[model samples]
Structures are given as structure tokens and as C-alpha cells.
Target: MNAPLTATGVRFADTALAQFLCTNRYTSLDELRQTATAAPRRFWHEVVTALGIQWAKPWTEILDLADGPMWPRWFVGARIDLYDNLVGRVAREDPNRPALRWEADDGATRTHTYAELDQEARRLAAGLAGLGVQAGDRVALYLPMCPEAVVTMLATTRLGAIVVSLFSGYGPDSVASRLQDAGVSLLICADSFQRRGKSVPMLDDARAAVARCPTVRNLLVVARGESPAATPPDGSHWHTVDYQQLIAHVPVTQGPAIHPADTPLMLIYTSGTTGKPKGVLHTHTGFPIKAAQDQLMAFDLKPRDTLMWVTDMGWMMGPWLVFGGLLRGATLVLFEGTPDHPGPDRLWDLVRRHDVTHLGLSPTLVRLLMAAGPAALPDALPDTLRVFGSTGEPWNDGPWHWLYDTVGQGRRPIINYSGGTEIGGGILACFPGLPQKPCAFAGPIPGIAADVTTADGQPANGEVGELVIRAPWPGMAAGFWQDDARYIDSYWSRLPGVWVHGDWAQVDGDGHWYIHGRSDDTLKIAGKRVGPAEYESALVGHPLVTEAVAVGVPDPVKGETAVCFVTVADARRLAARPWPEWERELAEHVGTQLGKPLRPARVHLTRSLPKTRNGKILRRLVRSAYLGQAAGDTTSLESPDALDHIRQCRPAGA
Candidate 1:
């Protein structure tokens, strides 16, 4: 068992969660969780009141469960708007304080104060309203991590329209499919953005998408940097407008459009690893409130701190950072470049320049940095960093310890956060005020009511089981957009009166929880079920291997055998000898570590594995591509050619 990380100088008394507990007459988080889970209505009421949630009108009821456990209405009959709470409230309190800090790949920098952002959002709101955008209309924002992306999101929400944000890396087909599904009336995009020193023509993709999406009538384009200003396609049915010119107009929005708390605010799609991406609908109150509560109560984030997560808008974490950071009155950082671009020192430079306090990264990114920049990385993290936040995927102890030892110097803790788009923020998260293990979650965030159960729906106390929630939280997706039956079948139908999140989870005797991997990706060999993370952890433990992905393939004798693909950090290891010898050695090493019963069937050396823009390995795609099966929904991949890399991998004796 790993020892919990000791908090040296951090005090629980100074945290916002401490005040929240004291206000509710609770002495500790455990007490609060017990009371909150038993009486969710009272807990939510007290929490909202204690936090001084910016409500235009007080709520009549905290929760209405008449709709059923799968669909719980929160803050019923209350008027609240995200624009008022996230930007306007902060601008009123401290207008000159920085709300957002942005830096592009080419060293372009911009900082927006709370007041400035408020005005810009209002200006664009008026521009959109003049173009016949009305409340409840859907507006799709296909933009990169630029200032306009932030402005357009706020502006659309200010007018009470639902914001559908697409990941910037998507192609025209991905864009058009979502546009038609949402029946979006307006599409906002950038002319171009930089990635790996190459100009990505976002406008070309947007135009092609709009041409295919008949529901779209107006195209709003932000001419990025000094790139040649793009012209609107001639003889198009939709109107084309300039984004900066829209912001230059007179500010016409007086205040937020009044709407009930349950009004739909945004529609975000899941990263489609399973199949087609499912649309998750979030209300104005549900997602934002849950995000702020999770960030504040778990990490003790303060307004004085700056937070950054290396992610793109297409993933859930992008909006999670924006809403959670801005609502807490913290400086939000946005980066538009690759971490290894220009120099491996880019992320470190951002940290020192911004004095960032909370930095979020994926375990995959940590492995990449460790392999790519052993020499370029600093001996210690910047002094300004108070916490290392991580999510998107599970952690193996090798990379986790390296980050904790090398970058953090054993002082700071890597707060392992685990959740997904459907959960809003986190199901299980580590608290900075408490002790922590290498990759164990401190437990369920207070009031989340998470549990573990076997596939047969039996209670699992000390063993791995399906991660589930007994009660609904504010952050859960209201429902799948236009597919309520699919939403029920996805989560609720799996178990009675429970939301079964599709991840293998375990809680040890010490009460620390750990995610194994996706249950869908779990491998069953000789009738022994094992999570891919186990084999993956052992494979990456090899010195030459930097990253790895494990998948189950058919075997006539054994039920299913594990086929592992790995990327080597040192090219010299490959050129030095035949790869088959080393492959057998590495496969035997996994057997030695995890036992022969779980040893992989084959270890294939691949140049690169397919991944999402957020750096999560898409195991489904890798497995399909290896079997020469159709790779479904390759649009979310960072590089389409990554699939071909898997196909081309021909390890000897396979």
C-alpha cells in the first residue's frame, strides 16, 4: 500500500470548504457528506446560500425528483444566468482584475479584465441579437482556444441561446453532423489557428461544413492574427460577418436575458471512443454550479490563484476549466500551442510567467514530457505552483511518482481527479487538505454518493467493480440532447436506481478509491477479467517504452489475449537489435510483474497510437485498426494517420 502524502504547511482552516462546513454546523467533510447524501435538498439549499450563488431570484425548491432519479431538476423555479455570475459579478467586484490570460503558439499574448470581457460579451450579444438570434436558439462555436472563443460563448449565453462548442481539430464532416443534429442557426469560427508551426484553415473547414448544414444561415468568422483575411464564399445563402467588427459595434445588451435555472445553456458532445459522440445537454445552473463547487471544495481554489489545464475546447475539461475557474474569480489561462512545440520549456515558461497556482495535465502528457524532455525540464516546478491537477485518464505509478518526485520535489501533491462529461466535474477527487496516495482519489467529492458494485449489481467493498452513483448531482447531463431514451439506457438502465459510470473502480481497505480503466476496454483472458491499465502500467514501466495501449483480441484457446502496442522513447533501442527479442523480453517482464496469468499475447512496437486532442488513448480505434476493422468516428483523433500507424505495425511472430 502507498502512504498518503503529508500536507506540510497547508491549513484546512484557510480554505473556502472550511467556511462552508462551519456555516452548515458541520465539523468535517465526512459529516457533511453523510448529511448531504441523506438529505440532498437541505444540503443544496445550504450550500447555495453559503456560497452566495448569484441568483437573480431565490429558488422555491432545491431539488424536484418527481421526474425520477435519472432526471432530477435542481433549483426549481429560480432565475439565474451564467453571464451574470461568471463575468458580470466579478467585473462589478473588481473590474480591473484579470479574468482571462491568453497566449498563442507564436508568442502572441492578451489579457482581458473582468470589465473588458463583460463589455465584449455584451457587444457580441447585441450583434448576434440584431442578426435575429433569439432566446433558446442553438449557436455552434467551432473555434480554437482564442479570445473570441471565450467572448462568443459568453455572448451567446448572455442572449439565452444554447451554445454548442465543437473541438477546433474537427473536420467538415464532424462539424456538419453536429450542426444538423443540433439544428444550429448560427456558426462562429476562426479564419485560422496555428498548430505545430502550420496554419490550420478553420474558415475553410467551417465554410465546407456550413455548405453541408442547411440549418445554418449565418457564418461569424474571427480573422485570427495577420493571416490574410478570408472572404465569404460568393452566392452563399447564409450571411457572413466579421467577429471583431461585431465587437466594435455599440454595446446593446443591458443585462442577461431572464431565464429559469433549468433552462438549457450548452450542448457538449462526448469524445466518441465507443461510437458516435453523444450530445450532453447542460442547464445554466446545473453544470456551472457543480463545476465551481467541485473545484472549490476539493482543491480549495482561491480567486487569487490562476488555473490552467492543457486541453482543447472539444473535450469536457475545456469548458470545465472556463466555468469552474471564472466562477471562482480565478485567472483562467488558455494556450493554443502544442506542449513540445517551439521548445519543451513552453509549459514551464507559461507557469512562471503567469504565476500559475493550479496546473492540470493528463498522465499521458506527463509520460510524454518525461520521455521528450528529460534534459529540458526544470529540476523543480515553478515556486508559484501550489497543486498539480490531473484528469482525462488513469495514472500508472511510474509516471505519477516521477511527476511527484522530480517536478513537485515531494512537497506538492498530484490531486488525481476522475470524472467525465456526463458527471459535470468529478465523481472522485483528491483534496489538498488531506493525505493522498500516488493515484488514489481522496474519495467521492462530498455529496456525490459514489459507490462500487459488481457486474451482477452486488456490492463490491474491497475489489474492483463498476463505478456508480446512488443519487443524482447537479452536474450530471440533464439528458442526452434529443435522445432521452438513449440517456436512460446509457446510465440508468444498467442498474436499478443507480447511474453506472462505465469505468472499473476499486476501493481499498483504507477507503482510498482508484480507477482501473474503462470497463468496455477490460480484457478477459482465460476467463480472468483484468483492466487494461494493469498491463499498461507494467508495459510503461520498461525503460525504453514511453507510452503503451493494451487491448483484448480473440484467441481460440484462451477466452481473449491481450495485444499491447508501445511507443519507444529511444530510437537507438530499435536500431540496436531485432525488435522481436526485446518484445518477448518486455512481454515476459509484464508476466513477471503481473503474473503469467495476465501476460500479454504479443507486444507490438508502433510509431504512435491514436489519441484524442486531450491526449487520451482511444483504445477502441487502436483495437479496430489492428484487426483491420472499420475505425468508427475518426474525426476526434488528433491525427487521422495514427490509425494507419497501428495498421502498419507488423511485429514478428504475431
Candidate 2:
């Protein structure tokens, strides 16, 4: 077995975690973790008070576990509003502090102070009230990541209304499905926004979506660029208003609406593995507190830090960034274009120019940058960088090392966080103070009772198993919107008393945690099981390979066999050698590294893999294409054409 990486004395001494441990009287990370897990209620209470969380009315109890671990209610009997804690209090305390900074593809930049952001949110809230949108009403935001999007979200939540965040990239059908399901009463969107140096029409899709959503009574549009004015088409029943004009005369001194702790804050839909997207509902106390807690403990976010995560408004990370950064008093940076546009170093440029202290991105993006070669990277690491954050997908060693060495310059820690929209924040994350190995988690976040367990419920170590939560945390979704049964079946059905998160995980002897892959994506070959990531990591470790996806295909002799789909770093190198010889060598390399039984039965070359907008490879879709089966739920696929490449390159007859 390989030895675990150990942090140097200087790195450990300078971390925020070191400060926290000293202040809290904890000797080590292990001591802190044990204390946090021993009594979660007390830990959370301390955390909330330490963070100075504001509430309309204090809770009589910290937690209500009477309903069982799966349905634990947190912050019981408390009355609060998200905007009060996130925007109102911050604005009052530091009115001139930088709250938001946005940069466009064309080099246009905008910054908003805390006071300015609060006033804008109040104006939008007043306008929403004028349109008869009251408490509990669902308002869909179909705009990109801009200042207006943040304003609209805060405004809606301030009025105790639920905001349905629609992905800006979604077509009319996708937008309509979510809007109709949520029974949205109003929609706020942008006329157009620049993507890859081109004007993309968003309001046009919003208009088309409204035509199909009979529940929407108003359509408000923001003019994002100098594109043609957006107007409601002929014979539309809904009233159309310019966003600026609608909020122009609204007062900016109104107070936020008070609601109980469990008041629905937002209806964020998950990209479904099957059927329509499930609405993952969150409340004022549930999502915001959890997001802030994670930011504070895991990332050690500070008011002076500028935190930026590359994501769209439609993804969970979008709201995560807004609520988490603000609650922690950090300046949030928003970018409205591709990271690699204009040049491969555009992301690095943004980091340098914005003085981003904590920069987050997907491993897929790092792979793209790696393919561009080291020359594409900045000559030096950004001077202000304090931490590197990553999520969205599991990391491969190649890109992980590139990000660690080339980007972070071996001076900062890479905080690997993993969770889903349903969990609100991370279940497992690496702290800056801990020693980290490539692709390993420090442990479960404090206050989250997470473990890796076998099928029969025994704890498993040194072997991959299901990632389960033994106790409910504040961020657990309040069941799927209008579908309680489906929510129960999806998460709780797999384990008796635990929340079975659909991922394979393992814990090493030294206490380091590792997420293998999605449990559903596990491959069973000759009665032996393996996560797809195990094969992918092996294949990507090869010199010439850039990306790879391993899938289990039906086999007659063995129950299943591995089929590998790969893309190369240099296509010219492939043409220099015989294709058959190269494929054989790659398969033998896997056999040599992982044993003969784990070797891929066939290797197929491809140009790209099917991935989501967030860059998570769709292994199920790849398997479907190989088996000539219907690809279920390609709605989240970013490159649908990548499936055609998989089908074209599939090996003939098993």
C-alpha cells in the first residue's frame, strides 16, 4: 500500500483550521471530529452561535429526532428569513463592503456594494409584491449568472416566495417542464447574453416556454446586451414588462417578510436519472445555514476572501455560491462565459485580475487545460490565491496533479468537496489544515454522520461500499416537491435507517476517505465488483490518454465484461502507430496494473464522452449507446453528439 501524504509543519501551522482548533481547545482534527459526531445537536448549536446566525425567534430545541434519523428537523420552532441573515444584516454592518463582482465575456465588469445589493433586492421585492406575487408563490428565474439574477433570487426569497431556478441553457421544452411542474406564477429572464463571443437569445426561449406554461401570468425581461428588444408575441395573455422599468419606481426601504424556519425557500430541480426532474425543495433555515456552515468549516471562508465557482444559475453550485459566500461575508465573483474562451488561460486571467482567494472548478475543466499544455497556464500562480476548491465530478490523478502543481503551485490546499443538490452542502470535504493525498477526502464534514457501509449495513473500511448518512443534517431536502413517495424510495429505501447516497465510497486505514463513483455505475465482472472510476483512473494514467470511460457490457461466459471508451491527448501520435497495436497495448496495460479479470474486453477510441453541462461524464448514456438501447434522460447532456461517436466506435459482436 502507498503511504499517505503528510502535511509539512509550516503548511499546518498557517491554516485557518489550526486557528479554529486552538480557539476551540481541540488538539487535533480527530479530536474535533469525535466531538462533533458525539453530540451533533450541541455541535450545530455551537456552530450557529459562533457564526452569529440571526433568527426572528430563537428555537426552543436544537433538533427534533422523534420522527427518526431520516426525518430529523433542525432549528426547531425558529422563525427566520434568508435575506435577513444573508443580505440585510451584512448590508447594515458593512454597507460599503464589496458584495458582488461580475465580469462579462466582452471585458465589461460590474461591482455591487452590500448596501447597493440590498437596495436592489428590496426594489425587486417591492415590484414582485406589486405584481401580486405573495408568500409561497413560485417565481422562476431563467436568467444567466448576472447581478440581476442574484437580485431577483434575494428579492423573491425576501418576500417569502419560492424561486424556481431554471438553467439558462435549457430549451423551451425543458424550461416549460419545470415551470409547469412548479406552477410558477411569474418568470424573470434576460433578453440575451454573450456565450463564446456570440449573443444567445434567452428571452426568446422564455417567451416560447411561457406559451406552454398556462400558470405563468407575467413575463419580465432584462436587457442584457444591445440585442433587439424583446416583446411578447401576438395574442399572449401574460403581461410583459421590462425588468428595469418594472422596478424603477419601487421603494427600496421595505423589510423582509418573516416566515417560520421550514418555509419553502426555493424549488431547485435535480437533473433526473430518469423521468422528469425531481424538485429538491429547500427552506430558509435548511439550505442557507448548511451552505454557510460548510463554507465556514470546510473552506475557511473569510470576509476578505473573494470566492468564485464556475457554474451556471441552473446548477446547485449557483445558489450555493450566493448564499454561502454572502453568509460568510466573502465577495462573490460571477463570470458569464466559457472559461477557455479567447484563450486557454482565460480562467487564470480571471483569477489574477479579480484577486480570487478561493477558486473552484470541475476536474473536467482542468483536463481541458492540461490538454492545452503547460504553456497555456499563467507564468505564476495568482498572488492572492488561498485555497483551490473542486466538485461536480470525481478527479483523475493526471488532472489532479496538474491542478495541484501547475495551478496552485504547491503552496495552497485543494479543498475537494463532494455532495449533491439534495444535501445542500458537502457531506465529505478536505480541510486546509489536513494532509491530503490525490483524490482523497479528509473525512465527513463536522455534524454530518456519514460512513461507508456494506450491503447488509456493517461498516466497511479498506473496501468500497455505499456512502450512507447515519443521521439527518439541516440541509437534507424536505422531500421532493409534491412527490413524497418518490423521494423516500430514491434515498431512504436502500438502507433501513440511513440515507443511502448513491455513491460508492471507501475509508483507508489511515482515516482518509475516497469516493469511487456512483453506486449505480458499478461494474460486476465474473462475480467481482469494481467502480468505473477504478478503470478510468488506470486508463487516464496512461501517457497518451486524455479521457476515458469504462462500462460493463453483457457477456455470455462472465456475467459482465468491461468496455473502455477513450480519447487521446494527441491524435497525431495515434496515426503514427498502428491503431490495432495501440489498442492491444492499452488493454494489456490495464491487465498488468489491475489483474487479468479486470482488463477491458474491448477498447474503442472516441473523440469525446457525453457529459452534463457541469462536465460529469454520463456513463449510463455511454452504456446505452453501446448496447443499442434507448438513452434515458439525455436532457442534461451537454454534447449529445458524443453519444453518436460512442455508437459508431462500439466493437462488433460481443
lDDT of each: 0.86, 0.85
Model 2: what TM-score?
0.97
Tens digit per residue, CA lDDT, model 1, 260-341: 8988888998755556779999988888888888888887787868988899877888888888788888898899888777
TM per prediction: 0.97, 0.97
RMSD per model, one decimal: 1.7, 1.8
Clashing pairs in 2: none
What's the alpha carbon RMSD for model 2? Answer: 1.8
lDDT agreement of model 1 with the native:
0.86
Model 1 CA deviation exceeding 4 Å by range: 7-9, 225-229, 273-275, 650-654
